[model samples]
Target: MGQAGETPGRPDEAGLGARLVALGGLELGEFDAVPSGPAGASAPAGAPVVRTGEARKRGRRRTHLISAGVAVAVLGFFGTAAYLFVDVGGRSPSAAPPPPRKSYPAVSAPVAVGPQPVDQGVRTEDDLHLVCQNWYHPSAPRFRGDSPHPILISEDGGAEVDYRSTRTLNQAAFAGSSAQRRAWAPEPRRAQLVACLDLTGPGRPIRDCTSGSKVLPLVEGKYRLTVYEVSSHRKVVDRALTGADRACPFVILSSVGDTLFSAVKDRQLYDLLRERVEG
Candidate 1:
């Protein structure tokens, strides 16, 4: 009953589809394209669709791979920074540090020698001049006759030296003797001599020398004594003297001579004498 080339229900169907579209429904063509269940059975409306297992697995793998790459990049940056910090700023292993400084006790002033003239009986060489003298007495009775007489001597107007007389002589006789009498003659069997340079300054002389325990026959020869600086306990002088020097004076008086003579080359004796003299 339709006209040629016209669909029988086409116009009516188009109008109904337009009316549905205006009501916010799907287009008729789109609605028909939605798949139905098995054998084209219609599914229940408004149901949520779940994703497949393979799709979920693929998504998780991509996320994990991206996280691993980020972690690696961050670790590499930190490692490079740490390496630069040590290489540019640190000290070398072979470099040595400075040594520590040493300290010492303060030194006292030099001792002043005598204004009195040395005894004329005391023998002297033309090259030497006597400056000062000191003596130490012996503590033990057996050593009473043996005393130390430290005589300060100047050579060629240079620094002072200590010439110690190791002898037992009568002080009164030696002091009172005239030039011709020769009363101050030292006993050859009981006399010897030793010399050392005075390291202590004026008024602070440190006498150091060495001698035999018992008197030996006086053989004219050179004897050496090592003198030490009292403050630092360091050796300052090593000197020698001859027994034949006539100007080298004998210690006066047996007891006084003994008191003045003990400290030479003897540490205990030196300490005792220092205590008594200083105290």
Candidate 2:
């Protein structure tokens, strides 16, 4: 049977062409029927192609999804890079400490000037002249007795200031010798001491240990010299000659003694005894 409303028989070939021409209003021999092959027949020409709405919508959705996926990939790539950078170098830098200030010393007080009268120590060697120019302090205020006291010199211990042979000792040792106070001095008492000083102190039993010094130091454990008025048994010079004085020169001691030792008592005892001996 025919698929359409035709009789179930092979159509006459010449008539078939004419029938299709009449139906389709085409020329009679425009289409010649070819024999059917094992490959089978194709669809008739000029068929209308219709598509479903769901299929079109599905295609559009797939395009939009692909575009969105690409955008998400770009965003995720930048996001991952930024996250890694922040994780690796997220901490802030620490600040450093400052340096210390510069340093220096403080200023000192000013120096003193003028003559220091207070007995500082012994005189120096530079001022050991024939006459002392800087006799800052004299043992006594002034000389008394209107008559000059010629010194009656005597000594117990000391290498210097000898009374035995001053003329020979001066020429031998102390001739041109330059020392502030020579431990071996042989100065002339009358010539050296042009004046006298009162060196009397609180009477104490003193030991004149004036050994091997230029001046007869009033130290303990040495010589003993006692002067008295011959006419009377009165002791005129009973005081010790342990020279520990810190006063100015007695004109004679300034020439012999220095900052360490002094002969003020030596000169004082000489004058006190000289008055009794000569008079």
Candidate 3:
């Protein structure tokens, strides 16, 4: 045992070396020198290197996983690029967006607004006229629902230009003690008084503005009214109506007419209408 291995020169050295050799392992600090591996079997003989079946399969699987990951990454990159550049749904930035529809806040309940001013005009409409199809004429002391007035229409109101001056509701050139007209409607030549809106501005009916040829179905909205005294072109009354108030677009016009009429100049009629409506 003495010279068969490297010497442990002293008795104490020999005893300590025997004890350490018997140990399975020793606890070590991070910076402590590590012992070399136990003496091992040498590589197999003739071919100089060898691989087991399990090791070969593990290497193949690792290669396959790397290839699959690369393919997925490539697909993801191109997909993102297509999404950023393509106009998938044909919507283009240059196309003008449709105008937003107008909306009005509903009043707490259907109520009247004013016989106030031309700037604050009443607007009423439904898909089709029911109660509102006609207008009232105090001169005739009756109401007619016919639009654009059988008489007293704007010069630009209809295609009746050929017979504009001569046409009447009936076949002949006739006289009517009663007449039907709207607020924006031009007054009869004989009316002598003008609508109140005539002084402020003209209210263009939706029917008048868009087509001007045919009677369009009424759309949902408030209907506005204004009146003018024909001869002096004096504005008698103008106001706006919402909801139920829309039932009578030019309700004030008749009362206002009373103040202007020579025969029935009831001055309180205009004030009475205003009080009722404004309430």
Candidate 4:
């Protein structure tokens, strides 16, 4: 029973199909009383209706995917941040300030100095000439001979020699004792009998020079000595040729290595010295 404008409440033709529909708990002959017009919306023909449980299941799956994505993004952000912090912490303290740039002193060539000797424990003559040791310090009156000669020392303070009498004969070869040589080592090479230092030119002086020879003199007495500052053959040449006439024939050069000549206990230079004596 259906009206002209009314939909069916249930199908009139019923059979096994209706019984199967009933078993599924669905009323197959019944119609939903929904208004179908242009104003009211309805499902289009041949469209499937989704159940509330299936829609809920799809919504749950989408929510789970979104949550997993958020978790992965959060983990990536924290991991990157942690790596940066670790890298910064592992670095050394700002590279040690570049090692303080070495600063060196700027210098050119070395300077050249003249010939000079160090002044330590050096002695000087009465005239202020440099001497190496005392005449009577340890070894006095060094005399080398076949037999030891009784050392005859002068009565004066410094052993002065007479040039005129000492040079009359040849007595330059006789070397003194070891003790006497050591005592006279500080003073320049001098003659016990010779007098006067002749400075004539700029080469080696033609003095009575001796190295390894011996000579015998007829007479032995106190004689005038001429002391000269000698270093090498060249210096000896320069010294003998460059200075003015000295005050005494028996003279000694200044120990400062200067080209100056001076006199010691001379009868002319010192009024106190009547006669200079030497051993």
Candidate 5:
């Protein structure tokens, strides 16, 4: 059937019908009616359309990517935090213990000094005046029922000179046993006596003297004596005195001003002298 004015279907309509037939499983009747519109006003032909299934699949893939990125970031943050906690916590190798506090010895208080020795006699020799004193502690212990005595000699009105015994002569000479005597003998090549001489001028006194050596007359032997000069520190005399003269018993001979003075001691007289001097 044909309508005279419609012209047996428009060419555009025929093309649309042909396109509907070409589409797989689409019937021509389904798009047979087309709304009349300006050709340029409709959606552009052959543009790609997004299907629901493909859109949903793309959205899921995007969500999975975003979720994976977030998980990775979260894992990195937590891993870094855990690493920092372990490094900083407790006794790590990086953090060493404080060095042990330096331990110092305890300081002790100063000790108090006791009384000093007292001077006794004043004897004059030419231009030189001498003072000899005995120093002994009042409460000192007795030796063999006798008190111990130490002597101090001062020459030319100077400071006191202490004579240190090189060997334990005074005590050992009075020892009751022969074993003690052998033990108290002076060592070989060692000084037997030591005297500190203080020479006084108008200024400070000088204390510089070499040690002296003496062989006990009771024991026959050769010995050397050393003398020191104060004005000029020269070894003026290095002489040896050898003799076998037995003039005085219990005598301690000492040289003073080119003459030998004997410190004589007998048991009865010595007790009397000690009593008088000590008192």
Candidate 6:
């Protein structure tokens, strides 16, 4: 049997060449025939090559999948961050209190007391001069006629006024210097004035006692002096004189033995008694 255009039963080389030329329409080409036996024929020369088109397409598909996965991961991270920020922003802050204000004092009504008569010519320390004067309510407490009165000294710049009870204790101390027992304190719990006020004005005149003080010459004996205001209340003081004239410059009102001190009785009685007392 013949294989394709091969000559069978004849090992004729010319016939094989002629068959090859007839099958391929070649112009009597010369070729060497490869012999096949127990030993196989040698393979054709040159290296084997694979096409790259399908491999390049598969690599591009893998790259696209990886990029999509990275994009999804980045988007999830950003969304989670935004959700946490919103949750933290939903809480509140703290609350606080208010402030304070300023303050002042209240006004009061004027007191009820009569004015005093100013004696301008009543100057010189030798004569008893009335520099200042004041008054108090009759119902006000009074320990004695010589107690501190509602009278302030202009020399102290009108800052304070002594009540009637305080004046009494001070004068008593002065008078009690020669007594058997000097007064260390005021008499315990006596009827005296509580408060006093100054009712003097600039129009009123005062005797200037800027220089020497007054001296009242008296015999060695004990004498009592009573002081009266415009009303009936009186203050009396029993003064003892051992030596010469004493400077009784300021008036001392007292209520020692009598119900009313003479100076605090009526103005006429006080004037009459003061004149009779012989300087």
> Which number leads on lDDT?
2
For candidate 4, the lDDT comes to 0.31
Which clashing pairs does model 5 show?
none
Per-residue lDDT for 1-279 in model 4, tens only?
A: 655755444443335345434444223322122223222245578644422434434544665677689999999999988777768677445533466778999888998654344333223232112211112211122223332122111222222322111111112113554544323222412212112332221322223312235221111122232332222101111111222223323333222122222222323211211122222
lDDT values for all models: 0.34, 0.36, 0.30, 0.31, 0.33, 0.31
| Every model: Cα RMSD to truth | 19.5, 26.2, 21.2, 19.5, 19.7, 24.1
Candidate 3 lDDT, tens digit per residue, 24-46? 22223211222122123244355
TM-score of each: 0.23, 0.19, 0.19, 0.24, 0.24, 0.22
How many angstroms is residue 244 displaced in model 2 relative to the true structure, after the best TM-score fit? 14
* Candidate 1 TM-score over all chains jointly: 0.23
Collision count for each candidate, in order? 27, 17, 27, 8, 0, 36
Model 2: lDDT of residue 175: 47
Q: In candidate 6, residue 126 scores what lDDT?
A: 14
Candidate 2, residues 181-246, lDDT tens digits: the string is 221241232222222122333333333333344444332222334442211222344444445454
- Runs in model 1 with CA error above 4 Å? 1-56, 83-182, 187-279
Predicted structure 6, TM vs. truth: 0.22
lDDT of 6 at 56: 34
Stretches of candidate 4 off by over 4 Å are: 1-43, 46-51, 88-179, 182-279
Q: Residue 44: error of model 2 in Å?
A: 7.2
lDDT per residue as tens, model 5, 16-49: 5465345332233334323333333343476433
Q: Rank the candidates by lDDT, best first.
A: 2, 1, 5, 6, 4, 3
